[model samples]
Target chain A: MELLGRETRERFGLRSRSQAGILIFSLVSTMMLLSSLYAAEASVFKKAREAAIETASPILKFFAGPIGWIEDRLGAISDYFRVLEQNEALREENAALRQWEEEARSLRGVIAALEELEAYTPPPAAKPINAFVIGEANDAYVHSMIVNAGANEGVSRGFAAVDERGMVGRIVDVSPNAARILLLNDVQSRIPVFVEGSFVEGLLVGRSTSQPTIAITKLANGDKIQPGQRVITSGAGGVLPRGLTVGAVAAVDKKEATVELAADYARSRMVRIINYKFPDVEATPLGAPGAAAAAAEISAAETAPATAADAANLPAAPPAAPAPVDEGD
Target chain B: MSTRADVLMRLAGAATPALLGFLGVILLASPLRLFGGEVPTPVFPLIIVYFWSLYSPGHLPAASVFAMGLTHDLLSGGPIGLWPTVYLVTQQIAISQQAYFLGRDLGVVSIGFAVAALVVSLIVWFVMSLMTATVLPLGGIFWQMLATVACFPLFALAFGRLHRRVVIEV
Candidate 1:
């Protein structure tokens, strides 16, 4: 290796020390790039990446502190300039919302009655963990952001992240106290979604733009996707929960449909990471041991006109019961 | 001055460019939305690397550039080594063309950076597309390159001042 290096340096007439440094570093960098591509899926590489982010999280948060303060001050100044107009808009919105609230109340009652008649069981409630956006990767090719919540805060990979308006993205990497969210507009992000009120199912694929297009996976005969139709998670892959509002279809062409994301990526400061666990099939099965006992207990509790506080005090049912068959049998 | 003090000053001078490069990475990764809309992030580390390579390649060095790019990749959650390779190759190019950029006015230097930024953006777009096995959009890359080129003069001015005041002074 030393002889080859000397011969190459002599042949190229590269006598400068800096030239040697460049050559050596370029070779090293090429090797590193190739190795990284080869080991992209290796666990060690993932761990190292997580560790680097974990170490840098504190430094990033420290740098973001002043930026946050500046943003707040700027927001306040902007708000002051538009307060009157905003107040009038808010008042109009409030009046309309009151009527919608009443309608929603009646709809809730109807849904409850329908659910009782159908013996329907709702999906498990999601636990939300709040996080602050500390960093963002608005680079040429990648669109992602770092949040100040991670495994320690009940955040896990694949957990859905949402702002007030709608879905933001999902957790892709998580350290102890930090996580990276692959935003909806990143080139690598893909989510299964279906247009609301239609049988048009498709994959929401990002193209490094604000509007991600839909790649149709399933479309029933004679069903057309139109503009302004809401797009939502299909839960087909079991990674994300079903029925989360993703976005609304903004434009539809013969071969492509784009969605206008609901979450305001540019101005979103806080997000809620939803920690949801898909329920196990066996855990909710009928005819298991203790099933009749649990049903009787539930019936007894239902027979009583319990107050809300009493409902809170009720004992929770076991998730699953063991089989009662003897070993000999 | 004491020998120890002189040594510390020399070390500080040597470390200044790399430190600024790291700072560039941190600032780029930080969510400092000074603008209200989706503004493209100017490639700060690229500017830093190019400036230092043109002026004093010994101070910033190729290794430090590699580290900065790796840190950026880690923070951005992109493919590791993707940026390090880009940065190292860019640095080499900058060093090779140092003679032309040296003693040039800000406008000329910035024009040079414009060309470099265009090339780097295309390289990144091509490599990323190849890695992902799909043709990535070019709009973001174009905006980013434009922003980087537009911001180059300001960064070059700052780094030039820092170079004169501290790097050469020490």
Candidate 2:
């Protein structure tokens, strides 16, 4: 290797130099192309990347369908073995949860039904389409995952993505057949949350680390945000719905509190797509500014710390769009 | 013993499966759906690349590695050049170590994979840091390396044989 390096140095002829120059030029041009690819808005490039996937997806599905079939055949052999263990575990856990369910039902019976129920009504989610994963880890550093479902499956941005166990992330970019999930572990991810203990509201931030943290701004530092206390979405920014299960306050580091998601973020599979779109512009096609109004408002609520001043704010949801009805109606 | 068809056959085997495996690995590693979110890291690609680099440089061209990396970049949504760059760097290392690798046994190769996984994981983490502020625990990356390195023998042997059989024929 050293000898070749030395010999190449010695072969500094005009032709050799010309070849070197051409190589250098081509190299620079490729770098420029890649840089431009990287420089585009994450959403634009994400869409383009999704477009690429859309074109390539069919080819992949062609292979995946067969592989999935084979895997199922093999998995069936193994499935029988875990059945006994699964049954015992579920029985024991069910007994404990049923106790809580009874206690909770008694409390609910006492509360006034209508107004309280309205506050507790869970938001509707988008129609989820399921797909088996056909790729490797998407990003380890960021808490994100890419699933096989995409726009063609009615998946769109701002939809909630959760595994059978718990919340994985929200959909950020979508192609025809695949979508990228921005996990609660992503540093850029922030959703409004309320402390179940005191209803103290704050935001859940996805820090690239495995354990995501909740930043409670409205509650003064040293407010009774104790370890083992629970946290949930407060529905402040209309992005995530009210009262979604986030996680418990695992530990408090100084003024900031870190949360450990109930579901294992590191290990997840068979995620459910909760087909909910934020109350912004409609979940329209690409370039449709349908959700613009809601998007801007949600973005503002996410970025600006909620304070006493914004506490009294209740921008009524736009009158429900008239349901698409039959001509007879 | 090597023939002209060697290149054609290796490409034939790895071409579809290597990229196919890459896509498969991403979905398997996805933390979206099921229990035990064990994500397969760059190990599959790394193993395929590393094994081919040592055994038959002819079958695995640098350009193919570049394309695989770009595909990974798009799917994972990391900075575009990061994985491709890591693939190239590792490919170069594999080629350079081929002489020493010729006589090494599986244990040594596993250790070599560890070293390579460490280097690739570190470089990927660093380049990815420049993209955004997602900072996953090093433990996650390290555990990924352990799993990938542990499984090296399977892919190495499988890919190596396919290289021999297909390349020998084509």
> What is candidate 1's lDDT per residue for B42-117, written digit by digit as tens?
8899999888888888787777888898898888887777788788877877877886888989898888888777
Q: What are the chain B TM-scores of all models? A: 0.95, 0.78
The DockQ scores of all candidates, in the order shown, are 0.67, 0.26
- Tens digits of per-residue lDDT for model 2 on A1-329? 99998876775453344334334433543473367446735555566667756665555556555655555665566668899998999999999999999999987675547446443433355566675544434355645566788877888888777766566677777877777777787656787777777656777887666677877778755567788888776767666666667788888876578888866654454577777655554465434553654686587778556543444464432232234344338
lDDT for every model? 0.84, 0.64
lDDT value, residue A293 of candidate 2: 44
Candidate that would win on lDDT: 1
